[model samples]
Target: MLANADHVMPDELKFEGDKAFFFAALDRADLIVHGRNSYEDQPNSPKRRRIIVTRKVGAVARDTENPNATLWNPHGAAFEAARAQAGVHTGTVAIIGGPDVFDMFMDRYDTFFLSQAPRVRLPGGEPCFDGVPARSPEQVLAAHGLKAAESIILDPAFDVSVTAWRRDNASSAARR
Candidate 1:
């Protein structure tokens, strides 16, 4: 998510470095999980395997238009089962989000790359996490026992930065 210092309205992020970083991660991931809204927003994303989380039940199937995509209703199916159905047995799964999705995977994330554009502010935009009381994404991650590693300045001209929050006790298998 690309947000201002306030971490609001992450909908219209257009930072080149942020996009590059996200695509780089996507390139390395075997599966991608995201909310319905996020999936709809990225209509032209490269043809990679993806699972779209939704509340409606029994709609889990490969997208007819996009063969690499699946519509998953987690309420009706287990995550492992969904992964297996997607033919992803072992490899990195990147969770891109809407706030609810992020909150759902809070405990499962071994590392979260939070990109921020300090110069931009979206006062009424949606937050990174919706219901969490934490003031910032860092606080929310910290609550889940993740600590921030050194931040990378993705774009010095725009004061854009990406901070990685990693779980201290995450098992080696989880890292894989």
Candidate 2:
């Protein structure tokens, strides 16, 4: 997400580097999980398999319109079951998000790729994560045990950068 300094949703924010990185990651992954709103906003790509998390549905069901997609209500089915239903046996599962979906996998993510466009700011837009008040994306991810590992300036002209964070087990253990 190319959010502003306030960490609000970047509505229709388009960054070429971001798009390239996202699609490349999707290409390598076997399953993509995202919130309903996110799924709806994204353009249809039948080549990749997807699981759209939605509260409106009561069960996991294959999308009739898209053979590569599945509608999953996490309240009704376990994550593993949903993946199985989507025919994903073993492979990388990318969590593309809305705040709620990101929050749901807080502890499960081995790594997080955070991209930001510091020049842009969406004051009233939605946040990247829910239930966290007045926190930066890095702060939120750090609270969940991830530590910044590498930072890359994807576009120097726009001050757009991508930071990769990995789970810090030692820090987490120390906290306990």
Off by over 4 Å in 1: 1-12, 40-44, 132-134, 169-176
lDDT of 2: 0.78
Model 2: worst 10 consecutive residues (lDDT sum): 1-10
TM-score of each: 0.84, 0.85
> For all candidates, what are the clash counts?
1, 0
User: What TM-score quantifies how close candidate 1 is to the native fold?
Assistant: 0.84
RMSD of 1: 3.7
**Model 1, range 10-70, lDDT digits (tens) per residue?**
4456777877787888878999998866642344474788888876548477767667877
